[model samples]
Target: MARILIVDDAKFMRLTLSNILQKGEHHVVGEAENGTQAVEMFEAEQPDLVTMDITMPELNGLDAMKKILSNNPKAKIVMCSAMGQQKMVVEAIEAGAKDFIVKPFDESRVLEAINRVLG
Candidate 1:
């Protein structure tokens, strides 16, 4: 099971993703409430994967992903976004995000994306 970090502004979204990851047998190494925290946690925890929310208060996922990738180009990050945020999602992929899951997440899709990224 891959170690994962969950990053999101909404507590419920983080919790939900945590549960899904746990159920998939992945270990959640940490949870970050904003992009800044996500960057710090990524350095500290060094999880195998990161589920990053596209929009956050401090720095935003795109920037956070950039920061992490700058430090570790191999960092595996899967972005999370609400429907209609397709543009950001594409940008994230172009920025080196492994994959993305739409919000109001589907368990199967979440697991699938994470697995693919981990692989």
Candidate 2:
């Protein structure tokens, strides 16, 4: 099972994702409410993958992804965005995100993206 770090400002979103990951048998190493926390948790946890929300209070997912990638070029991060955020999603992919899952998340899709990235 992959160790995953979940980053989202919304508590419900984080909980939903945590449930899905746990049900899928992946270990949740940490959860961060913002980009700053995400970056710090990433450094400390060194999870196998990260599910990062695009729009957050601080740092933003794109910038956080950039920072994480800069620290570990092999870091596997998947962008999580709401509907109609295609532009930001594309930017994330171009910046080295392994894959993306749209919110409100589909359990299968979320697991698929995570598995693909982990693979």
Candidate 1, residue 109: the lDDT equals 98
The CA lDDT of each predicted structure is 0.96, 0.96
Q: Per-residue lDDT of 1-119 in model 1, one digit per residue for the tens?
A: 79999999999999999999999999999999999999999999999999999999989999999999999999999999999999999999999999999989999999999998898
- Candidate 2 residue 108 Cα shift, in angstroms, is 0.7
Superposition error at 62 for model 1 (Å)? 0.4
Q: What ranges in model 2 sit over 4 Å off? A: none
Q: Give one digit per residue, the lDDT tens place, for model 2 in 1-118.
A: 9999999999999999999999999999999999999999999999999999999997999999999999999999999999999999999999999999999999999998898888
84: Cα error in model 1, Å? 0.2
Every model's TM-score: 0.99, 0.99
